[model samples]
Target: MNICVYCGSSLGKNEKIKEQAISLGELMCKRGHHLVYGGASRGIMGVLADSVMQNGGEVVGVIPKNLFKKEVAHKGITELITVDGMHQRKSIMADRADAFLALPGGFGTLEELFEIITWNQIGIISKPVVVYNLNGYFDSLIQMIDHAVDVGFIKPGNRKILRVAETLEDCMKFCEQEL
Candidate 1:
């Protein structure tokens, strides 16, 4: 299966989160799954891609042309695809991936995760969306989703679209079930 991971372009201050990203990459490789992600050679994105490659896993990078020009694109990935813009990049990544997972990140990561979830909600895609909420990183976000459901802003059934996993093991388990 091709698993698409949306993560930070910069590694956060926490060492454990970085380690978790590495572990997640290693797990994907060990499980013989291919990785599809934003093609950048910085932050958690770089670490995850490098770990997967080191473990002999196939990685497909979908980077926007602008970022590629900025020289943040991963040159060592199994395959690197450059798109014209962010929307095109996301479309190609979504098309290439069988499942989606989100790691700790800032606005970009949240945006990608929410976009994928929204796509699934609107029937644009039915792939599974998993969020790796390491150390309660996404606790508040999850609570907000629950609040949305309570206020009738979101359907109760739609809340299940985003599966929250606290560890790499849990994420892998969800992937296995979904795929």
Candidate 2:
């Protein structure tokens, strides 16, 4: 499977979260899955890519020209595709991925996650979207989603579009069901 991962460019202060990224990469390799992600050689992104590479897994990085220098596009990945901008980058990533996995991240990551989910919801894509809630990182977001469902802002069936997992194995299980 080719899994697109949405994660932070900065390695946050939480060591455990960084560890989860590393473990996820290693597990991806073990399961013979390719990684599709933003091409950044810094923070959790870098750590994840390096782990996959070190474990001999294919990694296809999509990076925009604007962030090439700022995010330090990873040159050591299996394949690095450069795009004109963020929109192009995301389009390429989503097109190439079989599933989407969201890790702990800030604004950009959240944006990517929602955009992909919206696309899936509208029939632009039909793919599994898993949220790796490592250490309850996404508890608040999950609650907000529930609140939305309760308030009738979102349909309960639509809420099933997202699958939350606590471990890489669990996340993989959700992705594997797409097969």
Candidate 3:
């Protein structure tokens, strides 16, 4: 499976989250899955790309030209594709991926995952989206989503578009079975 992983370019407060991202990448490679992600040589993205490459898995990184310098795009990637802007990067990644997984990250990570889910919900795509809820990092966000559903902001069925897992194995299994 070609899995697109959305994560942060800056490491968060917790070291465990970063470790879990690395573990997830290693697990994906071992399972014979390719990784598709933003080509940054920092933070969770960096850890993930390195893990996949070390484990002999294909890593396709997509980055916007404007942020290439700022993000310090990963040159060690199996394949790095540069685009004009964020939209182009996201478009290419989504098109190439069979599924999407989000690791613990900041607002940027949240934005990326939310965009994909929105795209899926609006019929732009039909790929499976999973969030690796490392250490319950997304607890508050998940609560907000539930509140949205309760307030009739979104239908209950729309909630089914996202799957949350506490571990890499659980997330991968959900992707293989549900996606």
Candidate 4:
């Protein structure tokens, strides 16, 4: 499986989030899954790519042209696909991946995850989307989602579209079983 991971380029203040990202990478590699993700060599991006490489798994990085010249691109990736802009980068990554997993991240990660989820809701892509709710990093977000259900802003059944895993092990298991 080629799994696309949407995560932050900057490691958040929480150390556990970074740990989970690394663990996920290693787990994916050990499971013989390839990784498709943003190609930054910093923060969670660096940890994920390095973990996969260390575990002898393939990693394909889709990076934008601006970031490439910004000199933060991971040179150790098995292959790096450079695009003209962020939208192109996201499209290529989504096209390359068979599934999507979102770890605790920032705005970029949220954007990527929301785009995939929205598309899934609208009958665009049928790929499975899961969120690694590391150390309950997404508790508030999940609460907000429930609020959306209560407020009628979103269909309550739409919550089924997202599978939240509290640990890397459980995340993989959920992906194997539910996705």
Candidate 5:
């Protein structure tokens, strides 16, 4: 399966979260799962790709041209796809992925996660959308989502589109689902 991961380009200072990236890569490699992610050679993104490659897993990186020009693209990845802009990059990522996973990240990661979740809600895609809520990184966001459902801003059934995985095992289980 091709699991599209959304994560920060800058590896944050959270040691546990950082290590989880490595574990995720190892798990994917062992499971023979392909990785589809933002092409960057830094931070959590770098660690994840490197771990997969080191463990003999295929990684397909979808990177924007601007970021590629900045020399942040992972040249060592199995394949690095160059795109014109964020929109194109996202469209291609969604097209190439069989599932979506959100790791700890910054604004861009959150945006990507939400967009994919929105796609599932709108029936644009029927794949499983899971968020790795490691270290409670996504606690507030999940709360807000529940609040939206509580206030009827989001239909209760729509809120069920997102699967919040609190551990690596949960994330992998979500990935293994046929959806």
Candidate 6:
């Protein structure tokens, strides 16, 4: 299966997050899955791509033309696709992937995760969306979603659209089930 991964372009302060990213990539390879992600050669993105490539896994990178010109595209990926803008990049990634996973990241990662969940909610896509909530990174966000459900802003059933996994093993299990 082709798994779409949304993660940081900039690695945060924690080295463990980078380790986790690499582990996730290795897991994908062990499961015989291909990666479809934002084509960047920095932060967790680069680490994950490298791990997958090193493990002899196929990686498909979808990068925006602007970012590609900025010299952040992963040149060593199995396949690199350049799109005109962020929207097109996301669209193409989603279209090509059979499942989606989100690693801890800043605004960009959150945006991509939410967009995929929203797409599933509205029937634009039915693919599974899993969030790797490592070390409680997404605890507050999960709480906020629960609050939304309580206040009737979001339907209760829709809350299940975002599957939360605290470990790489759990994440892989979810992916396998989805596939």
Judging by lDDT against the true structure, name the best candidate: 2
Model 4 alpha-carbon drift over 4 Å, by segment: 177-179
In Å, residue 64's CA in model 6 sits off its true spot by 0.6
> Which digits, one per residue and each the tens of the lDDT, describe model 6 over residues 74-110?
9999999998899999999999999899999989899
Report the Cα lDDT for candidate 5.
Answer: 0.92
The alpha-carbon root-mean-square deviation between model 2 and the true structure, to one decimal in Å, is 1.0
lDDT of 5 by residue, 84-135 (tens): 9999999999999999999999999999999998998888998988999998
By lDDT, the better pick of 1 and 3 is 1
Estimate every model's Cα lDDT from 0 to 1. 0.91, 0.92, 0.90, 0.85, 0.92, 0.91
Winner on lDDT between 1 and 5 is 5
Candidate 2 TM-score over all chains jointly = 0.98
**Candidate 2 residue spans exceeding 4 A from truth:** none
Residues 5-120, model 3: lDDT tens digits: 99999887888877887788889988899999999999889988998998899999999998798989999989999999889999999999999999887787889999999999
Per-prediction backbone clash count: 0, 0, 0, 0, 1, 0
List residue ranges in candidate 6 displaced over 4 A: none
Query: Which one wins on TM-score?
Result: 2
Question: Candidate 5: worst 10 consecutive residues by lDDT?
Answer: 63-72
Q: What is the lDDT of residue 145 in candidate 4?
A: 84
Candidate 2 global lDDT: 0.92
Candidate 1: lDDT of 41? 88
Per-residue lDDT of model 2, residues 1-179, tens digit only? 99999999999989998898889998998899999999999989999999899999999999999899999999999999999988999999999999999999999999999998888888899999999999899999999999999999988888888899998899999987762
Residue 150 in model 6: lDDT: 100
List the pairs of residues colliding in candidate 4.
Answer: none
Clashes of 6: 0
